[model samples]
Each structure stands twice: as C-alpha cells, then as structure tokens.
Target chain A: MTVATAGEFGLISRVTARLGAASPLVQLGPGDDAALVAAPDGRVVASTDVLVEGRHFRRDWSAARDIGHRAAAANLADIAAMGARPTALLVALCTPASLEIAWAEELADGLAAEAGKVGAVVVGGDTSASPTLTVAVTALGTLEGREPLVRSGARPGDVVAVCGRIGYAAAGYTILSRGFRSPKLLVEAHRRPQVPYAAGPAGALLGATSMIDVSDGLLADLGHVATASGVGIDLRRSAFVVPEQMRDAATALGVDPYGWILAGGDDHALAATFPSSVRLPDEWRIVGEVLPASLFTAGDGVTVDGRRYTGGAPGWDHFR
Target chain B: MTVATAGEFGLISRVTARLGAASPLVQLGPGDDAALVAAPDGRVVASTDVLVEGRHFRRDWSAARDIGHRAAAANLADIAAMGARPTALLVALCTPASLEIAWAEELADGLAAEAGKVGAVVVGGDTSASPTLTVAVTALGTLEGREPLVRSGARPGDVVAVCGRIGYAAAGYTILSRGFRSPKLLVEAHRRPQVPYAAGPAGALLGATSMIDVSDGLLADLGHVATASGVGIDLRRSAFVVPEQMRDAATALGVDPYGWILAGGDDHALAATFPSSVRLPDEWRIVGEVLPASLFTAGDGVTVDGRRYTGGAPGWDHFR
Candidate 1:
C-alpha cells in the first residue's frame, strides 16, 4: 500500500521498526520529541545536507537503499572531514504521499547500514508530505578533544594526499546516462560512494594540516582549501592510478579518464595535507604539494603539474 | 536577483551576512564542513523538522521571514520540550531557482531573530535547487546537568497544566483560511508562534513528571504523553479561559472556540504533568489530571470532562 493509505504515523512505525538498535552514544533513541546523545568531548560537531529527488538522485537509476546511502554519506562525510567521530544521525524526509511504504523502509535500512560502517546510528527523524521527495540529514560527531582539521590550516610546504576512490562516480554517472549498466562496479559507485570514513581521524592523528571531502570535484574542493588557507595547490597528473576496469569503461564511454579524476565529484574521498616531515601512511597516496598563493593570479589557486587545468567544467554548483 | 542568477555560493554569502555574530557556545561556525558547539553537560539534545511549500506554509499568505520563524520554532520547541537550553541551529534550504534572493535573506533574518531569543545562532547549513521550496532545520541544545523531562515519566496522580497560548494559532489559521485578515493578532499568531522558551526548563526545575510541546492540539499531544506514560488524561473544560479576541473571532467565524482550544495545533505551548504537591509557577495554569490507563478504552487515552472529546479531527497528520 502507498504511504498515503498507511498514513504518517503508520509509515513512521514501519520504517523505525526496520532500523537496528541505536548507538550507545545515543542516550535516548526515537519515540521522543528530541534525542539526547553523549558528547564525551564536551563539544559536538554537526553538519546538515539536503538531497532533492531529480537534483540529487533519480529513483529509476538507483534503488531506495542506494539513495539512502548517498544521502547519509553526504552529511557523514562532512563530519569525518572535520576529523571527528560520527555518533548519531537525524533525518527529515519529505515525500509524495503516493510513494510505497516499502521504498521508505528500504531507505531507512540503507541509512542504518551506511551509518553502521562508521559506528553511528540513526537516532531520530521527521517525515512530511511534499510534491518532490527530499531527504535532509543532520550528522552529529565528537572530536575526542583533538583540534578540528579546518580548511584554513594548510601551509605552503604541506604535502597533499588522497585516501579514497575518485572519478569512479563520474564514470558511473556517464555510464548510466548512456543507458549502459553492464559495468556494475562503476554503476554502484555512482549509486553509493565508498567513503573512507576512518581515514579522516587517521589523518588528523597523523597531524594533517587541512582536510576536505571531495564532493564538488577534487580541484573545486581543493580550491576551497587554497582560498581559505591562502595557499596555492599543484597536482601531479601521474599520481592518480586509474583502475583497469575504469580505463575500459572510460574507453567505452569515449572520455578522458584524467578529466574525471580531476573534475569528478560525489565520491566523498578524503583529501588532506600534511607537513613535509611527516611519515605517510600506506593508505594515503601523495598526489600534490601546497605552494605560495602569490605565485598564482588572484582567485586562481589550483593547477595541474604547475600549469592551469585544461579540463572541462571545474566542479558542481547547485544554482548555476 | 533570483537565486538562479546569483548562484549557490552568492546566495549563501548574502544570507549568512544577514545573521548576527555566532553564540559563544559555537566554537566553529559557518563556512566549514561542520560546526563545533560546546555541549557543557556532556550530552546534546537534537531535533529536526522540515517545512514544505503549500504544505507546512504558503508563500502567498505568510512572508518569507514568518515562514522562517515558524520553521525554526517547530524544531526549537522540541529541544525545549526536553528541558534543554538551545545553543545552535543548522538549516538545510531547498528552493526553486526562481526564488528571489531577498526572500532568502529575509528568511535568514527571521531564523537568526528566533534563535537569538534563546541565545543560539545559525552555525552551518546547506543549500540546494529544487522544484519546490523547502526548509529543514536542526536544533541542538544542552541540559546543563539536569535530568531530561521525557514523555514517559508521568504517574496517575499527577496534575496536568499548560503554559503559553493554546488556541491562538488555530484561530489565526481559521481566520486566514476564510480570506479575512482584519484581526492582526490572530493572523500574526498563525504566522509566528511565540513559544515559552524558558518555561520548559523552569517546569523541569519545579519537578515536572512529564512534559511535551502542544503541536498537535491540547488533547492530541496530551494523548501522546498518556500513551507513553501508560496513563489517562482528563481535562476540565471549565479550566480554559478563552481570550476575548479568540471568542470574538470564533463567533465571527461561526465556530466553537473550545474546539479550537482542544483540537488546534501549532501554538507550541508547553504541556506538562507535575506532582500534586509541587508548587507550580504563576505561568502554568492547572487544567487537567492524570488517571489510570484502565479508566480509558484501548487507544483512547484522553477525555474532556470524563468523556471522549466531541471536537472534530484530533490533530494533524502529514499523510492521511
């Protein structure tokens, strides 16, 4: 039956029943007006993100579970980018009343599964009826008393590194747009990003100077760091090792693999900068170096191999 | 300029500039992947609510600033219902690209104004382009070393009371629905609820057995408390003192004022149960008492003067 027939309270009960137990950090779970979560560090880190139906996902292209994963990853990655441990999640969903109840239940299951990967849980949420389906998630985290790895801390001599997949999601999107779904790996990447959630706190422990999740493409997000920290960033093209499967998919799609690596977004990869003296971990691949902002023209702080990028559009902008 | 022409970053900058300085509790504010707020009591209270266009609000009836106030109040009142002090707010805005930039700015002003009343600030948020305009807000609060007053704490012998306006919003809504807006007080109440922010913590301090915010009419929300606490609530109709203006509006609309007081929602008044021996503050008015759950039939936990409420619909449901 559709959600309209089940009603708001009935749908809530059905979806909440599918969710696993909440995290220990959640002192009070759902069934209350508000949730109480432990903030052991005396400070709580919070972030919010909204994903619209057509703007962020298409139901035909992805399953409800995949959409749930993507929505939760968008906000959870933000918390991880701050070098914090995610503890709880709050979701506010707006959906057409005609949608099936099973879709929402699967969505909740996906959210819980993704959150479980990082030792977090869905504590509470709200639901409403709207013409377009929308999911807004709020992620709460704790820093464990460590200083946050903000975007403004990168220095000119810091080494730039990345610890997760890049360009795969864009390749997947291209595949789906072309109606070719044989490449399951690439297609799944577009559906649900494989975020390296642990790498954020690990990099923070390794004394990373600055960090950000690659949501608006690698170059675009790094541009934020360079602008915020008043430094220039120079990337080496050879640093990104293209997977054999991805190369085959790119060849089939007739596009440059490096373009996707440079400008593709939605992978939620962790990109960070560290001091030149720091020993790097095996998971982090050195890709670039920070430079003095004075060396570049104003408002242009990112380059490839010490030259301006000749790739296509730099990144995603909502209203643009 | 419209949001489409201004772009996402430009609109964000414009709206954020209108907000006042951050609260001291916010260690790190906007312009980051996440915001860090102090949670001094070692726990944080959180809640989220979404307002959809033409559902939760109507742009033709209420200004953008009023909608903003209403959205923020809905979530902030949830935090207050838990007897916590609000410290921060995070907003996720989804809007049509054609929306005016000034409308968003005014909305930000209203959010800041409402948050400022509780010594909180807008710390961070996300923006997206959507076919419909929607605003989702998440509020964070701290308890300051006091036990949270949840909905399941009431006993059979407790006194039920309410603080703040109960029927004003419903009255205002009725007036506005009929295409007559001469009564400025009722119309304004419908646009923005004046929540008794301090009364929640004060009631908790005075040994409240259970507390809730009246969002779904007096009897309907009280039904929630009754179900959670496993008790029955019986209200004294004589205890209600309908405002003279409300009575006049009810007479003009050819409706029952008592129905509005009993079944109306969205006033955001505080409803709580206290031990019979506790001396309540002057703001609270005794209106009802808790009874054994056996006194009522299954799934029926609220009564008006020893009988089931004869009012129309009990409360709102997003999907029905």
Candidate 2:
C-alpha cells in the first residue's frame, strides 16, 4: 500500500513494529518523543549527514535498501572515524506522497542490517512528506573512556595509513555514469560500502594520534588532517595497489584509475596517522608519511611523494 | 557570493568561524568528523526532525534566520518533551548551489542563537547542494539522573496541564494562509515558535508522569498520552485563556478560536500529566483530567468537557 493511503500513524506503527524492541543500550525507545540511550562514559560522539535523492543517490542506480545502507554507513563511519564505538542511529526521512510503504520498509530493513553490523540500534527517527526524497542520519557513539581521535592530533613524524577499500566506489560511479554494465563488484562497492567500523577504536587503542573517514576522497580528507595538524602529507604512489577491477573499469572508461584512487569518495575508509615507532595493525597499511609544513607550499596541502600533485586535489565539492 | 562560488570547504569554514568556540557540553567541535559531547549522567536523550523548505516553511514567508531558529526549536522541543535538558544539536542542511552565502551565514546565526537559549551548542553538521532546501536537526539531551517522562505513566486521576503558548502558531498559520496582513504577533509566532525549554526539566523535577510537546496539536498530543497510558483525557473548555492576539485574529478570520485552540499545531507547548494531589508549578496551568479507559469509546482518545470532540481532533498530519 502507498503511505498516503495507509496514513501517518499506521505507517509509524508498521515501521516501529518492524524495528522491534530497542537494543540494551537504549533505555527508552520508540513511542516516546525522544529515545534515551546509555552513554556509559558520560560522553557521546555525534555526527550527521544528509543525502538528497538525485545528488547523493539515484533511485534507478540504487535499490531502496542500498540507499538506506549507504546513508547509515556514511554517518556510522563518521563516528568510527572519531575512535568511538557506534551505539545508535536516528534517521529523518523525507519522501513524497506517492511513495510505496514497501520502499520505506525496505529502507528500514537496510538501516537495521547495516546498524546491526556494528551492534548498534536504530533508536528513533522522523518521517515527513516532501516533493523529493531525502535521508538524514545522525549517528551516536560512545568513547568507552578512550580519548577521541581528532584530525588536529597528527604530528609531523607520524605515518599515514588506511584501512579498507579505496577507488572502488569511484570506479563504480564511473561505470554507472558511463552506462557500462560490467565490473559488477565495483558497482556494488558504490551501492553499499563496507566501512571499517572496528578499525577506528582499534587504531585508537594501538596509539594512533589522529584519524578521519574517507568520505570526501582521500586527498581531500587528508587535507583536512594536514590543515588541522599544521603538517604536510606526502603520499607514495607506489604504495597503492590498483585492483584489477578498478583497472578494468578505468580501461573501459578511458580514464585514469589513479584519479579515482586519489579523488573518489564514499568509500568510508579509515585514514589515520600513527607514531613512527608504533607497529601498525594488520587491518591498516602504510600509504604515506606526515611531513613538516616547510616541506611543501601552503597551497599544496598534500603532496604525491616529494612533488606536488600537478593535477590538483581531485575531490568532491558540494557546491562546485 | 553564492555557495557555488565559495565552494563547500570555504562555506563550512565561514559558518564555523562565525560560530566561535564550542560550549562546555562540547568536548570536541567542528573540523572533526564527529563532535564529542559530555553527557554527564551516562544517559542521553535524542530526537530528530526534518523540515522541508515548502512543506514546513517558505523562504518568502520567513527569513533564513527564522528558518534556522524554527528548525532548532522543533528538535529542542522534542528533547524537552522527553524531560531532559538539551545539550547539543547537529544540523544537516541541503540547499541549492545558487543559494546566497549570506543566507547560509544567516542560517548559522539563527541556529547559534536558538541553541544558546537552552545552553546547547551546535557541535557539528553536514551541508550539501540539492535541488531544494531541507534542514534536518537532531537534538541531544542529558537526563541528569532523572527518569524520562514517558506517555504510559498517567494514572486515572492525574491532572492534565500545559505550559507555554498554545494555538498561537496555528493561528499564525491560518492568518498567513488566508493572506491577512494584520496581527503581526501571531504571524511572528508562526514563523518562530517560542518553545518552553526549561519547563520540560522543571516538569520532570515536579513529578510529571507523562508528557509530550504540542507540535501536532493539543488534542492530538494529549491523544498520544491517552493511548499510551490506556486512559481518557478530558480537557476543560473554559480553562484555556484565549490570548487577545489569537482572539483578534480568530474574529478577523470569522473562524471559531477553539478550532485553532484545539487543532492548531507548531505551537510547541508542553502538555503533561501529573498526579492529582500535586500542585502544578506556576509555569503550568491545569487544563484537564485523566479518566479510566472505560469512560469513553476506544476511538475517543481525547475529550473536551466530558464529551468526545465532535469536530474530530484538529491536528497536523504529514500525509494529509
């Protein structure tokens, strides 16, 4: 049935009933004006992101469930990037009156599935009718007595590392944009990102100094770290392993795979810096090194080896 | 300059720089992937709401600053309705690329102003370019060792009370819809609601067993309390003191003021139930009583003067 036919209260009941009881972390759940969650350590890590239908995802390119999963991943990755364990998620969804109830249910199913990956719950959310579809997710996490990882903490002598896939989503995006159907796995990577949730808190425990999630492309995200820490980052081109799938897709599209590797976003990978003396975990691989500000011009926040990236930073800009 | 000219990072810096330092509740703030907020009591209350540009507000009807203020109030009121003190707000805004940079700056200004009312901070947010404007806000609160006031706790003999302005915003909506230019106060109320921020925690301290914000409408909100508590709510018609402004506007529109009083929403007033023997604080006025479930038909969740509301509860419905 369409949501418009079933009505608001009925739709809320159906969605909440499908969501089941709140997890143990939630002291109070749905049916209340707000959900109460246990924050244990007297602190909570919070972040939010909004996904517009056409701008963030295409209905034709993504399933309802995939859209939901991707939205959850984006916010959950932010919490993880802060070196906190994700505890709960609150979703605010906007859709049109003609939307099917099944679509929303599928979206909820996807949200629950992704949230369950890290043992978090969908605590509460709001739904409204709009001319277009938009999904806004807010993820909350608990530090569990550990200090949060911030971008500003990176030191000049630190080693930069990344855990999880890079350039795959970009490859997927290119394949889809070019209407090439091959490379199914790369397309899947663009649809549902497998964010490294465990690696975040693990990195903090392993004495990582600073961390960030790869949402706005690697170089763009690391640029945030560089500016915040007042240090320059020098990435080794040889350290990156170009997957056969990305290479194939790049060949098919006649575009440089390295561009996607450097600029592609939505991968939700963990980019962090560790002290030079610390042995990095198996989940992380060294990709670059943090350098003193004097090593590069201020305009060149991140350098590819000793030379500046002549192509400039390849990244997503919301307004551009 | 437009956001398209300044770029995403530049726009974010402009907004955050204007916001200045973080509040005491925020352990970490902007520039990080996520913000860390002190929750003190080990429990956090969270609520989220999405406001679509045309559905919730119009750029022509309200200023950009007012839109931000209203969005903050909507989510903050939900936290207050749950009987918690608001701590922080995370905003996710989607606007078109051609939006003036001044509009975004004014929006941040309004957000900061409203958050400051309850000593809450705008810790972090996401911005993206979309075809239309949408503002989604999530408010986090601390219980501070108090149990949240859920809807299920009202007893048969409990007194129904209300705090803050009721029916004003709805009246304002009616005025604006009909194209009446006079009664500027009512119009202002509709543009930016004055939610009773302190009354929530105060109600909890005074032993409010059940509560909800009047965003949907007096009768509609009370109906939730009734259904959740498995009791009937009987409001006294004469108890409500019609404001001179509302009365003047109602007369001008040739509509029953009670229609606005009973049905008008977006007022964000506090409606709550307390034990019959307790004296409500000055902030609250006794407006009704709780009755046994057997008192009326199952469909008559809320009544006025011991009779089922014949006009069919006036309230906002998203799909309707």
Candidate 3:
C-alpha cells in the first residue's frame, strides 16, 4: 500500500518497526514528542543536512534503502568530522503521499544499518506529505571530552593526509550519466558512500590539527580549511595512487582520472592536517602539506605541485 | 537577488549575518562542520518538525518571517513538552532556486527572534534547492536534572489541565479561509503561535503525571494521552470559557466555538495531568479529569462530560 493509504501514523509505525535496538545513549526513542539522549561529556555536537529528490538523488537511479544510507552518511560523517562519536539521529521526511510504504520501510532499514556502523540510533523523526520527496537528517554526537577538531586549526608545516575512497562516487556518477553501469563498484559507491567514520575521532586522538569530510571535493573542501585557518595547502600530484578500477572506468569514459581524484565529491573521505612529526597510521596517506597564507592569493588557497590546478571546476555547489 | 544568483554560500552568509549574539550554551556556532552545545544536565532533549509550503503555511497568508517563527515554534514546543529548556536549533531549508534572497534573510530573522524568546539560538543548518519550499527544524534542549514528562504517566485520580491558548489559531485559520481578517488577534495567532515555553518545566516541577503539546486539537491530543496512559479523560463542556470575539466569529461563520476549541488544531497549547492535590497556577486551567481505562472502550478514551464528542473531526492526519 502507498503511504497515503497507510496514513501518517501507520506509515510511521511500519517504518519504525524495521529499526533495530536503540543505542544505549538514547534515554527515550520514537513515539514521543521528543527524544532524550545521553550527553555525558557535558556538550553535544549537532549538524543537519537536507536531501532533495532530483537535486540530491533520483528514485529511478537509487533504491529507497540506498537513499537512506546516503542521507545518513551525509550527516553522520559531519559528526565524525568534528571528532565526535555519533549517538542519535533525528530525521524529518517529506514525501509525496503516493510513495510506497515498503520503500519507506526499506529507507528506514538503510538508515538504521548505516547508523549502526557508528553505534548511533535513529531515535526520532517527523513525517509530512509534500509534492516533493525530501529527507532532512540531524545528527547529534558527543566529543568524549576532546576539543572539537574545527576547520581553523591547520597551521604552517602541518602534513595533510586522507583516509578512505576519494573519487569513486564521482566516477560512478560519470558512468551513470553516460548510461553505463558495468563498473558496479563505482556505481554502488555513488549510491551509498562508504564514509570512514572511525577515522575522525582517531585523527583527533592522534593529535590531528584540523579535519573535514570530503563532501565537496578535496580541493574545494580544503579551500574551506585554508580560508578558515588562514593557511595555504599544496598537494603533491605524484602522491595520489589512482586505483586500478577507477583508472579503468576513466579510460572507458575517455576522461582523465586525475580530474575525478582532485575535483570529485560525495566520497565522504576524511582529510586532515597533522604535525609533521606525528607518526601516522597505515590508512592515513600523506598527500600534501599546509603552507603559510602568504604563499597564495585570497580564495585560491589550494595549489597542485606549487601551481594552481588547471583541472575542471573544483566542486559541487547547490546552486550555480 | 535570488538564491540562485547569490549561490548557497552567499545566501548562508547573508542570512547568518542577521542573527544576534550566540547563546551561552553554544560552545561553537555556525560556519563549522557541526555545532557544539552545552548540555549541562547530562542528557539532551531533541525533537524535529517539518513544515511544507501550502501545507503548513502559505507565502500570501504568512510572511517569510512568520513562517520562520512558526517552524521554529513547532519544534521548540515539542522540546518544551518534554519538560526541557531549549538550548539550540538546527534548521534545514529546501527552497526553490528562484526564491528571493531578501525573503530568506527575513526568514532567518524571524527564526532568531522566536528562538530568542526561549534563550535558544540557531546554531547551524543545511540548505538545498528544491521545487518545494520546506523548513525542517530540530530543537535540542536540557532537562536540568529532572525526568522527562512523558505522555504515559497519567493515573485515574489525576486532573487534566491546559496552559496557553486553545483554538485561537484554528479560529484564525477559519477566518482566513473565509477571507475575513477583521479579528486581528486571532489572525496573528494563526500567523504565529504564542507557545508557553516556561510552563512545561513548571508543570514537571509541580509533578505532572503526563503531558503533551496540543498540536492536534484538545480532544484528539487528550485521546492520545489517555491511550498511552491506559486511562480515560472526561472533559466538562461547561468549564470552557469562550472569548467574546471567538464566539462572535463563530456566530458570523455559522459554527460552534466549542467545536473549534475541542476539535480544531494548531494552537500548540500544553496539556498535562496533575495530581488532584496540586494547586495549579492561574495560567493553567483545570478542564477535565482522568478516569480508569475500564470506563471507556478502545480508541474512545476521551469523552466530553459523559459522551463521545460528536462535534466534528477530532484532529488532522497528514495523509488522510
């Protein structure tokens, strides 16, 4: 049955029934006016993200479950980017009344599964009927007594490093736009980002200076850190080892893989700056270094091999 | 300039510039990946609400500022209903690209102004482009070491009370629907609800057994409390004091004011059950009494005097 037939409360119950056990941090769950979550560190970290159909995703291209995973990853990664452990999620969904109830149930399942990866739970949400389908998620987390790893901590001489996949989702998007789906790995990455959630707090524990999730491409997001911290970032072009599958996909699409590696977004990878003397873990691949702001002009803080990137547009903007 | 011309980052900077000083509870505010808010009580109370254009509010009926106030009030009231002091709000806006920048700025002003009423601040939010205009707000609050006032705690001997205006917004809505706007007080109430932010914690302190926000009319919401608490609620129709203006409007519209008070929605009044021995403040009007579950059949737990309310539809259902 469609959501319109199921009605608001009925659809809500059907979807919520698919969720697993609540996180221990949740003092109260759904079915109430509000949820109570433990904030043992005396502070709570919160972030919000809205995903609109056709703009952020298309039902024809993604399953309901994949969209749920993508939405949850988009916000949960932000919490991790702040060097916090995600604890609870409050989702607000606005869908057309014609939406299938089973689709919404699978969406909830995807959200629950993704949240489970980081020990978080979907504690509560609101639902409404609209002509457009949109999911707005708010993630709340705890810092565990550590100072938040903000975008303004990168200093001169700090080494820049990244963990997890970087350009796979963009490559997948390119392939999908071309009506080709043979590269299942890239296609799946585009549908559901594999965010490196653990690396955020790990970077903090290891004394990383600053960090951000790669939602708007590496260069574009790094530009944000550079502007916030008043520093310049210079990347070593040779340091990036393009994966075999990505190179293959780029070759099939007749495009340079470097463009995707440098400018692609939605990978949800963690990019961070650390003291040059800090010994990094195996997953943290050093790719660049933070430099003095005097080395670059305003709004052009990121350089490739000591020069401005001649590649395509740096990142995605909601409205261009 | 329109949001498309201003771009996402430009629109964000423009709107955030209109905000006042940050709340003391906020350790970090907007412009970061996430906001860090103080939760001194060791637990955070969170709620989310989504308001869609045309469904929840109309541009011609309510100004952008009023829409913002309404959206923020909806979520903040949910937090208050849980007996918490609101600390921060995270808003997500999905708007068409052609939306005017000035409209968005004024909307932000309204959100901030309403949040200021309860000492809460808009800490951070997300923006996206959509065909529909929607505002989803998530409110975070602190309980101050008190247990949450849930809806499932009422007993047979508790007294049902209400704190704040009931049926004003509904009356205003009816007036607006009929194209008669002379009742300025009721019309403004429809544009923006005057939520009793402080009464929630006071109710909890006075040992309220059960509590809920009246977002779905008195009888409908009381029915929810009765169902959850496994009790029955019997309201005295003679106890209601209808304002002269409302009665006049009802007469002009050829309707019953009692129907508006008992079956109309969106007033955002707080309804709670207190022990019979508790002396309620003047703002809280005792309107009903709680009875044993055996006194009523399933799904018919709330009665007016001694009969089921046959005035009209009891409440709203989003899909139905």
Candidate 4:
C-alpha cells in the first residue's frame, strides 16, 4: 500500500498494511494511537529510541523509507540483543504538519521493510505536530522460556564473541562524514543497518554468557559488559581488525580503521561473552576475553589500541 | 534526588544502579543505548506516544514533574488496556539544551514516580537537543497466558461496562483550557491521570467480551470498540455522572456536565463488554449493551442520544 515504486497508498497505508499483515502480538496494529503487544511469559522485553530530524537522520541523507528502516533497525537490534525474538514495534512520529504526508508514509514503509527482515512488525504509535521530525520507536521481544542474557553475566575468562559486524556502521558513518556523495551503501548503512537480527537468539540458544548490541563503540560497549559483570575485558588487537568490510570507509577517511573498529558505534551488532567451548556463528569472531576486575590492563577504559575515545563523540551520547 | 524531598545522584549514578536491578524477564535495562525486553508467549506488545511541550502540555500549566507523570501514564495505561502488565519503559527527550539540568531531572522524577505506580521501571532512553521540550515514551507489556483483550471482541448482546471515571479528564482539560487556575482536584487530574491499571488484567481474568481504554472521549472510544467488534453500543447516559465530582467541575466550567461526561476524553478508563452473568466490580458500572451493527449512532458515522456530536475536532490525528 505504501508506494513501492511510484504510486501507492503513500506511506501511511502501505506501511500500515504491511505491518498489519504480520501476526500481531496484540489485537491491533497501526491506525490506532497505540498497538497492543502480548507477553505470554509474564515478562516482556522492551526498548525505545528517538531519532530527531537532524540529530538522528538527515532528510538530505535518507529517503523517508530509509529513515523508517533505520528507526526500526535501531530498536529491533535492542530487542534482539536481549536474546529475545522481536515480536512487535511501536512508533510515534512528530513532524511539521505541513510536511509531505507521503514522506511520513514512506518512513513507515522503510520501517516495515526493515522490520520484515527480522519478522518484526509495527503494532502502534502516535503522531504529533513539531518543528522537527522526531521518531520514537519501542521494540518488544519474547523471551520464549529462556533467561535473559544480561550485560552482567560476563565472567572472567569468558570468550568475547560478536555475532554481527562491528565498526561497519561507524565505517559507513565515516564515509558520510567525509561528505562523500555516492549515498548508496554507506548511506544505507547509516539509514538502515542490517544488524544480525537473529544472531541474538542464536547466542541465547547456545546459552550465551552475556550479551549486548553494539550501538556504541566496541570498547565502550564491551566496557559495559566489564562493569556490569564486575570483571574486565581485554581486546585482542589481533582479532579486532579481522573483518575487512571495515577498511572501505577507513581508507576513504584516511583515519585509523581501529578507531572505527574499536570505538566506532551504531552497528547494532550483537556482542557477548561465551564460555570458551561455545561455538560462535559464522560472522561471529573472538574479539577479547573477560578478565578479573583487577587485571584489566586497557588502562582506564581506552580502546584496544590504547587510544582514548570519549567526550561528546564517544559514540552517540544523547545529551552531547 | 530529583526534588527537595530526598537524596538524588548524578545522572550517571542513577542510571548505573537501575541497570543492575535483576528481573528474570529483563535481559537488559540500561547503561546502553537500548535495553532488551523478553517476550513471553513468543510475542510482545509494543506501543509508543509522543508529548509535545505546548501542544500536549504547557510548562505554565503543568509541572515538569507532572508532565513526566502524564507522559508515562498515557502510554502505560495503553499497555494495560491490552490486558498486559507493563514491564519496561523507554523514553526519548528532546529539549532546548539550555534548559536547566534540574528541569530534566525533575521530569525524570515524574517519570519514575508514575512508572513505579504501574510496576514498570524506566529501562533506557535517549536525550537530545531541541528547541522545545518533548517527551516520547514507549511502553511494553506482557500478556501472560491469556489472549489479549482487544477493541473488537464485543459481540451483540454483550453488556457494556466501564471500570473508571469517564469525563474527569475532559473536565480537567476544560479547567486547564479556562486558564490554568482551577480547584486542586481539577488541576491534579490534568497533571496526573489515575488509570484503572489493575482492571485491564482483571478484564482478562473476567473474560471481557471486548475492551478499550477511554482515552479520546467515551463516545469516540466506544465508537472504536463498536467498529472493531462489528457491533453497536448503546449507552444509557443515566449510568454516568455521579453527583459530587461532576458537580465539582461543572460548577467551575459552568457547562452542561454531560458534555464532559460523554464528549470529554483522556480518562484512561477501561470500557469493556462482558457476559450478563458476570458480576462486575464495584469500581465499574454497566453503561450500555452491545447490539447488532447499525443499532446505535452518535455523530458523522457515529450517533449519541439521537444527536450527532459531529464537530470533528479530530481525536488526535497523527503527525499533528
């Protein structure tokens, strides 16, 4: 219903219907102010993200559909990181009342498009008038009788493995930052990331030790696993750059690939510490190992290469 | 820590403590860009809402704390309406960076206060720079073992009942519209809504024929139920409007008390249809009966009291 190519129901109808077609956890999907999600385990996995017009996405940088995808991908990745299967999504959008209605619809199209990739669907949301376009999304996932994988579960000597690409989102971000104009792959990465949507549950199925989504840089995110587990994590520079997709934007930007690989964020990749014997998925690779709290030699929470990445740009700080 | 009443910590400290609170359902709560929610029943319920500064609330009209409470209440109440117990909340805030840190903190206080009432904790959220204050909340709920109660379950011959006050919110809104000066009761209702949070699950337990939260005016909300259920609902205006409270606001607004009683919305009350043999709770009163479609009408495509309330203000359109 949303315009796939040219003429469609615009963004509202198309995206609404697309989401509607999915098996809803609740009794309803879009068209209402909110969607209903079901929780059978007497528990639910929930998360939210808000994308501002200029802060999270740029109209000049993305198609409306792509924006929707980015929003869904961001939130869905959160649910996935919990080792939960994404069930539904709630989205509230605020934009200038005069903005193209089609644009809003397209955004939904993008959202449905991305959500479909992981079998997640938009359930419900709100709309309002505002000077800037703000998209707030909440993703829900089912635990499916499994214990949640938490950041605190990492223990010393647990092997740190990633289920998706790191630094690629940052690498993609670097390309956009340099004012490059191709706007295909990198821009798509920035707009709609293909996070290892299923890898989260895969890790959980394998009894993952601890898990997380890589929205922030690997160092910072892994640092959280360290702090939560009350242990330390030491990255192997050797294993850090094994992935080459990270090199594209690094070469283009003339910056150290390690920074993006280690400190760049927004890939929505899944990172978890597993017992050394746990088998990892194909994309997954050993990046580090959990250490005793006193043994952390990264020295004051710097990247693997010992480069400090903090302050306003230490990945995506909401306030900064 | 957000008010003069007690101890508070830096944002970082507060976020840190909340992150570790253990719950079997929560794989993650905070310390990252997003938190994970476990879906029981292999499904999850998701919904989102965005509140604008002046359009949704006026700083002069409602305390920042109250605004925070209302924002959370609105969405949490929605999840409840689906017969779901609220589990986690994600918030997105966009405000003028120059706003006092206290304002933001106070807002957080309000959010935590109300979220506590629903047994839901704030999990994770994003904060950013904006010209105006914006609070967007996404609430997730678990359905447990029962099927979700939806607006479409009502059938002909079902008894229509309500579990909370119908027009109190509209009455309160009227007071705010008249100029933020009103009795404490009226002002409080506008600032903080008291929803029948328990009744939603109760409805599930009671085998509600169909249900919906009375958010947009009783008639409007019923219309949704009727449309969804493919049935008609005939309300006995006589059932609504008890003396003390209705008189209290009516005296202030000096309008027909019935206007607020029937046309006003945002009460967050639960309206449901049930079998006639089911004993209703004292907190609820039977107001109508579901009939075959085309049996009742209000305004436009709707009918109330043989009079159509067709001055379409548009019960909250999306994208403003």
| lDDT score of residue B127 within candidate 4 | 62
Better of 1 and 4 by TM-score: 1
Scoring each candidate complex against the real one, what DockQ results? 0.90, 0.85, 0.91, 0.38
Per-residue CA lDDT of model 4 for B163-220, tens digit only, reads 9766676677778788756667756787788888899888889889777777767777
Interface RMSD of each: 0.7, 1.0, 0.6, 5.9
Q: After superposition, how far is residue B77 of candidate 3 from its true place, in Å?
A: 0.5
* Stronger candidate by DockQ (3 vs 4): 3
What's each prediction's TM-score? Answer: 0.99, 0.98, 0.98, 0.84
Q: What is the DockQ of candidate 3?
A: 0.91
TM-score preference between candidates 3 and 4, better one:
3
- Model 3, which residues run further than 4 Å from truth? none
Predicted candidate 1 versus true structure: per-residue lDDT over B1-320, tens digit per residue: 99999998889899989887767799999888899999998999999988999888889889999998998898889989998889999999999999999999999988998998999899989999999899999999999999998999999999999999989998998898899985888889889999998998999999999999998788878988999999999999999999989999999999999988998989999999999999988899999999999989854599989998877877778875
Q: Which stretches of candidate 2 lie over 4 Å from their true place?
A: none
lDDT for each residue of candidate 2 in B140-223, tens digit (9 for 90 to 100)? 998889999898898899999999999888888889889875598888998899999899999999999999999888998898
What local lDDT score does residue A157 receive in model 3, on the 0 to 100 scale? 97
lDDT of 1: 0.91
